[model samples]
Target: MKYLVMVQGSQADYEAMRGNGSAQSPAWTEDEVKAMYAYMSAINDDLAETGELVDGQGLGEPAGTRHVTLGEDGKAVVTDGPYGETKELLAGYWVLDCASLERVTEIAERVIRCPQPAGAPVYPVVIRQIMEGAGDDVC
Candidate 1:
């Protein structure tokens, strides 16, 4: 089965990582960021070696996002991102072909332990199994 594991962030979190501290969080040092990147890379490397990693990527800041919807006239209506400074946004994800939900859950648990500054807030990692087809199951 394939599972999608995700981690969320807010603009505040982004700013803090870039050395702009928010009232609720401290600025991350350069070393701290490097540590985080190295830790996550190690996990991905391990998954790839185990033949479980299908795809993975880290997203850019939410400020650059654009939203699109179909207008009443059947035209595309577009708007900039609505994520406020503190609003949560999808920050990164990994698509893993795993043997079972329990295995994916273990991976998600590892994601939650990614390195961060001591005062940084802990975010939850979400996991959802990818359906193979329409007849597979309804989520």
Candidate 2:
């Protein structure tokens, strides 16, 4: 089975990415970013060697985000910027081909511990199993 491990970052992280000041938490410093990159690199290397890593990449800041929705009259309504109260945003993701949910959960554990700021809290990772194709075998 394939599992997607999504890294959901907090508002503090969002502020750091956009060069804005975080109201409550401190932004991720340069050293923290380097440490995080190094940790992620090591993990990626390991997963690639094991043939478990399909693909992954960190996302850019939410400053460039856009939202499009249909209005009551069915017209498209477009809005820009990182709108309301998004405490957590999808920061990155890793797609892994694993044998079991338990194994994927284990991978998530290691990913959660990826080096960040000294006093920063651990962010949540949303793991989802990729279902088989529609035309595939039923049995």
Candidate 3:
């Protein structure tokens, strides 16, 4: 089965990495940033060798996000981010193809160990199985 593993965390975390803001943020050293990438690459290498990793990528911070929704008049409405009322957003995701739910869960567990901000708490990873395509109908 194909499962999508989503990494959920604060968008501020990314900003801090880029040295953008966060008065309370610790100094992100150059070595630490390189090490973070190295750690992530190692994880991806392991998964790729096992043929479990299908694809994955990280998303930009929510500040650059444009949230769109349909209005009552069926018009598309657009709004900028730094959205309110949510601390956790989908930071990134990994698509894993594995045999069982247990196997997929294991992949999600591994993802939780990836790099994070200094003194950051353990974040959450959401896993969901992708449903097969609708049967041969083009309606």
Candidate 4:
């Protein structure tokens, strides 16, 4: 089965990572950021070697995000930036082909352990099984 393992954050979190600390998140030192990248890279390498990694990537900040919705005229209405009221946004994700939910959960545990600055916000790592079918109604 394939699983989507995600980590979420807010704009404040992104700012903190860039050394602009706010009450919502602490500033991350240059070394601390490098450590996080190294750690995540090691995990991805291991998964790739084991054939469990289907795909993975860290997303850009929310500032450049675009929101689109259908208008009354059936045309697309576009808005710039993250969701109007959403405080948290997806920061990164990994698509893994694992043996079971338990296995994916184990991987998520490692993800949650990624290095961060002291007092940095801790958000829950989400794991969801990917649904695959052709109108099979596997909701």
* Whole-model lDDT per candidate: 0.90, 0.79, 0.77, 0.92
Model 2 clashing residue pairs (backbone):
none
Residue-level lDDT tens digits of model 4 in 62-83 = 9889989999999999999966
Q: Which candidate is the best by TM-score?
A: 4
Cα deviation in Å at residue 18, candidate 4? Answer: 1.0
How do the residues 6-107 of candidate 1 rate in per-residue lDDT, one tens digit apiece?
A: 999877778899999988668999999999999999999999999999999999888878889999999999988754654688999999999999999999
lDDT of 4 at 57: 98
lDDT for position 18 in model 1: 95
Global lDDT of model 2: 0.79
Best by lDDT: 4
lDDT of 4: 0.92
Model 3 pairs in collision = none
Candidate 1 residue-wise lDDT at 95: 97
Clashes of each: 0, 0, 0, 0
TM-score of each: 0.89, 0.85, 0.83, 0.92
RMSD, one per candidate, in order: 2.8, 3.5, 2.6, 2.3
* Candidate 4 runs further than 4 Å off: 135-139
Q: Runs in model 2 with CA error above 4 Å?
A: 17-21, 134-139
Q: Can you rank all candidates by lDDT, best first?
A: 4, 1, 2, 3
TM-score of 1: 0.89
Q: Is 2 or 4 the stronger prediction by lDDT?
A: 4
What tens digits encode model 2's per-residue C-alpha lDDT throughout 1-139?
A: 9988999775467676344446555677667778888999998998899899999998876666678999999999998767567766788999999988998898899998887655565678899987769438666
